[model samples]
Target chain A: MGKPKKEPKIKRKTYIDTWRFLFQIGAFIAILVNPFLNYYFHVKVIQGWYQSIAFGHLWFVSPLEGIEALLITKIIYMPWIIGMTLPIIVALLLGRVFCSWICPINFFYEIMDRVHKKISKRSYYKRKPLFTLPRWILWVALVGELMLAMIVGKPIFVFLSPPGLVGREIMMAVFFHTLALEGIIVLIVLTTYLISQRFFCQYLCPLGALLAFIGAKRRLIIVQDMNTCHQCGFCDRACPWGIYPSRGEAEGIYCTNCGSCVAVCPFNARKFVFVGFTPSSEKLKLEKVPSGRQ
Target chain B: MKKENTSPKDSDKRNGEISRREFLRVLVGFSLTLPELAHAKSKFFSSPVHTNALRPPGAVPEDLFAGKCVRCGRCAEVCPYHCIEMLDIRHGLYAGTPIIYVDKIPCYLCMECTKVCPTGTLKPIPQEETRMGLAVVDKYRCITWKGEGICRSCYNACPYKDKAIYLDRLRPVVNKDHCTGCGLCTAACPVTPKAINIEPIYSFKVSKR
Candidate 1:
C-alpha cells in the first residue's frame, strides 16, 4: 500500500511571544550586569545603557537622546551620528522592534502585566480610562521635550527615562554604594502600571515617539489576509497596543512588531511580511494559502 | 465588544501627513514651551557649582559639560580609584552628572575617566595636562599659613609635590601654574573645613552663575 502513505507530518505552530520573552529576559540581564562588567571585571567591551551604549569602541545612541543633544548643542557631533545610524536603520527596517525586544522598561511592564492579569482576571486594555491618545500628540510631546531640553540646556529625558534611570541606579548602587533620587521617577512610572499596562509607551515616552516617527514606513510589518482572516477578533485581543489587525488598523507607527497578534491567530491569517517589496508577488503569495484548515 | 470597521479613507485622514489637528497640537506645544524658554534666561536649568564638588580631570568647560554629557556613567565605572560620583536629583539640572567631592574622595589623575568618556564631555588628555581646577591654599584656614603649626600635610600629599606644592620658609605654598587640582591636598588636609581647597577657578565663568 505504498508504505501506507506516511502521514504528512503536521507542524505544530509556536508562539512568537516565546522568542520575544527570551529576548526581553536577555536584555534585562545585560543591563543589570553591564555596569558590573565595566567596573569590576574591567571588561571594556560594552559600556553605557539603553540611552547610549558602546560595543568595543563602536557606539550606539538612542535617536531621541541624539536628537535632543543635537537641538540643544547645535553640534553635529560625529559620535552621535555614528551611534545613531544602527538604531535608525533598524527602526526603518523592523518598525519599533527595540520597544518590543530590547527596552528593559517594557520587560518590566510585561512581567507586571502578567501579575495584573492573574489578579484582575482580565486584560488591562479592557479596563476603564479608555482615553485613547491621538497619535499626533506624540509629535507634540517630542517637540515639547526638545524645547524643554533646549531651555534646560541638558538631555532632559536622560534624567527621566525609565530604562536609563534603571541602568543608572544599578551603576550608582554599584560604584557609589547609594541610589540617586532619580529612582523616584522610575518608581512613579512603574506605579502607573496599576492604571494601564503600557500607559507610558502609548501616551508618553518621547523615545518611542521618535522611533515610531522614524519607522512610520517600516518594511517589515504585520499584513492580514482578509480571505483567510474569518473576521476573528483574536488578533485584536492579542495586540498589546490596541491596534486592530483584523480591521486593518495595525499601522506601522503604532505597531511595535511584537508578534503577539501573529502568535494568537488560530487561522494563521496574520503574518510579518516585507511589504515594501513587489506588491503583486506578495499578494499572490497571500492568496495561494488555503482559506482555512480542515 | 462591538467591532468598528475603519475605512481606508478614515484611517488616511486621521494618520496621513500633517492634518489641521496635528498643526494645532504643534501650536499648543510651542506655546507651552516658548514661555519656559523665555523664562530659562534666569538660568534655572544650568549647572550650579557645589563647594568641594569638582569635575573630573580633562572635563570640558563647565558651560558645555551639561549639554554634552549623556550621563552614561562610564566615567565613574572606569575610575580605578572610584573617585567619580554621579550627582543626585537634588543637584537640579546637573543630576546624574559626575562630580568628585574632593573632601570625600579626591581624583588621583589616573586619566581613566577621560579615556572612557564617549561624549567628549571629559576630553581625553595626558595626566599632567589635566586642568580640573587650581588648588588654592586657604591661607586663613591653613595651619602652616595661619602660623598654627608648620604643617606639611598638603605639601606631602600633593602628587606633584616639589612643583605643584612647595615649602617656603617651611610653610606649604601652592603654585597655581603647576597644580592640576587633583584634590589630593584637600582630602589630605588634616583639618575640618579643609585648609587646602580647590577654588575651581578654571570653571569660574559658569560656576559663578
Candidate 2:
C-alpha cells in the first residue's frame, strides 16, 4: 500500500513580515535624518518623538511609557498614540506580531543575527546562559526605577537610557560636540553593542520586560501543524529570541513576536494563533499526531 | 572509545571568567570618565543667582552686565536652576539658596544658558522679568561727584534714558529714585575699586504676581 500523502501547505506572505521590513527601513531613514529635522524644525526630534510628547516628557524613549502617559494625561487625537496602543489590542487578538515584526530594536537584532551568522560560520545556539538573564534583571530594574522615581521626584531612567544615549549622540554629531562627554557615552554604547546581539533589548531593557510580562500566555502564540513540521527544525533555527518552536507553543515570556519563525518556516505549517479565551480544537487535534512523522 | 564532551557547567565556568574580565574593563573605563560626567551633571543641576535683585524699580535687566556674559560660562550652568533647587533650602535654610554673584559681574540677564539646558534645569525667564539684584553706586570714586575729573561714562551707558547718573555743572549726581539700580553705571565706571558699584538689593523681594 502506498504511504498516505500529506496535505499540501499554502504559502503566502504575512502582514507581520511586510510590516517588519518597512519599519526597519523607516527607522534607518529616521536615524539618518534626525539631526537635520531637529535643527530646522526646532523640535527635540528623535525616533520616539510621538512617544516622548505623549509621555509629557521623554521618559526612556519607549513608546509603551509614552502610551501610559497619554492614558494618564487624557490627550486624544494623537495618531502615533493611537498607532502604539492598537498593536497591543491586536496582539490579544492575533498574538505578539508586534515584538517580532514592529519593534525597531528587534529589527536591528535580526539584521545583526544574519551578519553574525555569516561571519562566525557556526550555527547560532539557542537558550544561552546570558539569554535568560535579561528578563529577570529587567524585572528587578523596573521595580527599582519606580521606587527611585518616587524618592527622587525625578525620572532616573533618563540617565542610563539607551534611546537618550542615541539622541544625545545624534545631537552631538550634528552640533559638532563630538569631543564632548555625550559623544563619549555614544562610544561606550556602541562598544557594548559590538559584543552581543540585541544587547540592550535582550538584557537591559526594562520596557521590553514589561511588554513580555503583559504578553506571557501560551494561548497567544505561533503554533505549528505537527504532521507537516517534518522535524526539519527550520522554525527553531529561525527564532531570533532563541525560542524552540517544534517544542510547541512559545512560553510567551521570551517571545517578542518578531514573526521571524513564521516567515522562515519552509513547511508553511506555522501559524500565529491566539489560543486564550477559546483554545483552537484544530490545533489540539494536530498536536495528537504520532511523534516520528505523518 | 571516543572522549565525551564537557557538560554545560564546565563551559559556563569558562564563559564566566571571560565575562568577569570584560566587566572589570568596562568599570575601569567608566571610572576614568567620572570627573567630567560629575562636572556636567552638577553644572546642569545647580541653581543660579537672581541678578535682578540688585536692580532698582523699572530698570532694564540687560543694562547691568555687558560682554562679560557669554552665557556659556559655568556660573549659570552650575546654578542648580530648577524647582528642586528652591525646595532644597526652604526649611530654615541657613542663608538662602545659591544665586549668581551679581555685585562682581552684574546679572547681564543674557538667558543663554537657559536656552541650552537639556532638562529644563535653568527655567528660562524672559529678558523683561529676570531681576538679579539692585545696583548701588559708590560715590567715593565718582569723577563728577568726587571732583577727580569729568568722566560721564556711567551717565552715557545708563539705559534709563532720563539718566541714572546726571551731570550737575560737570559733577555727577545719582538720582536714587530714577536709578533703577541696574548697575550699568557701576560696570561702565572707569575707576579702580569702581567709582560706581552694585550692592545686593534686599528689599525688593520677587513677587509672584
Candidate 3:
C-alpha cells in the first residue's frame, strides 16, 4: 500500500431542510383538511386555521391577532395571551421558524421561488438587488400596521395577510362553495417572487415582522466553524432569503431557519448552534471571519 | 465581484442607522395621513346589513363584531345545518366574517358557532337565550292574512312553536321577545319573497324597524 487507507467520515443522517420541508407541506395539508373534516364529517375535534385554531376546548390565536385584539380592545384578554404562548416561545428560541416550517403562504412562496430561479436564467427576468431593504423597514411597516389597526379599530392587516387569506379562502371554497375576493391578495404577493425571492415575507408581512422582532435575540442561530469553512460561498447562493451564512451575515431576525445554507455547505461547517452555549469568541468572531476569508 | 458581494451589506448597515432627515420625513408623512385614514375607514369600511341575513346566535352588536372578529371561519365550519356562511369580498371590511342566510338555510341554534369563537365576539350562550334577531311576519304576504288559505307553516316551523309563533284565527302571529329569529320559518315558507323575514336588530347597518 502506498499509504495507510484513509477512513471515510460519517455524515450526519438527518437533514434539517428535509424536516422543514415536511412540516411546511404538513401545514398546507392541515389547512385543507381542517375544513374538510368540519364540513363532511362534522368533526369538531380541530377547528379554525392559521389565524386562530381551536382543538376541542383548547384554543389559540395568532400572535399578530392577539396583539391587535389587545391594542384595539385595550383590554387584557387572557385566552388570547394563553393562545399566543406556544408561538411566542418558539419564536424566542428558533428565530422565525414558523415562516419556513409552517406558513402556508411560505409553502407556496417556496415553489414560486424555485420557478423564479429557473426563469431568471433567461435574459428578460428582472431581479431586484438582493437584500437592499434595511431590516428596520419591517419594524416600520409593523408599527404602521398596528397604528392603522388602532385607528380603524379593526384587525385591518388580517385582510391583507396572505396566510390568513389562504386559510379563509380554502374554508370558503370548501364550506360555502365560493372563494372570497381577498384571495386576489395571495395571488398578487406570489407573483412578486419574479421580482425578488420572499418579497412578501421580507418587505411586507406584518405578521413576519412581529415574529422577527420577537426573535431578534433568538437562541438557535446559524454559526460557522471558521476553521473548517473554505469561503466556498455555496451557502450564499443556496440561501433564498439572501442571507450570506458563509460570510457570517446571518442576521438573527432575518434568518428563517430554512437550513438551505446547512444543506448546501460542502464542508459541513455551518450549523444551528445555541449562542448561549458557544464561547464568547466563537459568537463574537463573526466579524473577523469575513476579513480572513477576503 | 467581491465588491459587488460586500457592498450591499455595507450599504444596508448604513441605511439601518436612521438619519435625522429620514426620521423627520416619516414623522411628517405619518401624522398628516392619520386623520384621513381614520375618516376613510369609517366612511368606506362600514358593514352593510342585508335582509334575511343575520349574525349567528351570541354575536355582539354589529359595530363591535367587526373589530373583535378575527375572521377565523370557525363558526361556519362547525354549523351542523351548514347555515353559516362567511361574507365574501364584495362586503368590503366584512369579508370572511360569518353570517347566516336565514332564507336559504336557517341556523338550527346548535350553539356550536358560539362555542368555537376564540374571540368573545360570539359569546357562548344557551339556545333559549339566543338573541340573533327578531322574525317579522308579512301580513300581506301570509296566506292566512290574504284569505287565500289557512297556513300554520310559520307557527309549525318555529323552534318554540307555542311561545315564539301562535295561531290567532288561523293566522300566524309573531311574539318578538320569544322569537330567536333562527329563520326556520322563512326557509320553510312556500311563498315567493318569504311570508316572514329575519331582521338583524342589533346591527347598526339596519335602522330601527
Best by lDDT: 3
Worst 10 residues of 1 chain A by lDDT: A1-10
Ranking by lDDT, best first?
3, 1, 2
What digit string (tens of lDDT, one per residue) describes model 3 on residues B61-97? 7767777788888888889988888876666667678
RMSD of 3: 11.4
lDDT digits (tens) for residues A19-130 of candidate 3: 7778888888878898999989988888888888887877778889778867776655466678889889999988798888899988987776557658777522334554
Q: Give the DockQ ranking, best first.
A: 1, 3, 2
Among residues 3 or more apart in sequence or in different chains, the pairs in candidate 3 whose N, CA or C atoms overlap within 3 Å are: none
**CAPRI-style grade of the A/B interface in model 1:** acceptable
Q: What are the root-mean-square deviations of the candidates from the true structure over C-alphas?
A: 12.2, 12.8, 11.4
Query: lDDT by residue for model 1 over A62-101, one digit each (tens)?
Result: 8887777777767665766888899999999888899889
Predicted chain B of candidate 1, TM-score versus the true chain B: 0.75
lDDT digits (tens) for residues A193-257 of candidate 2: 55455555666665565566656653556666665666777777767664566675353466666
DockQ of 1: 0.31
DockQ of each: 0.31, 0.05, 0.30
Query: What tens-digit string does per-residue lDDT give for candidate 1 at B1-209?
Result: 23345465476564557978889999999999987776664445555555567899888778777777888887887777788888877766787788998888899998987877766778788888877788877888988888878788888888998999999998888887789988999999998889788877776565321
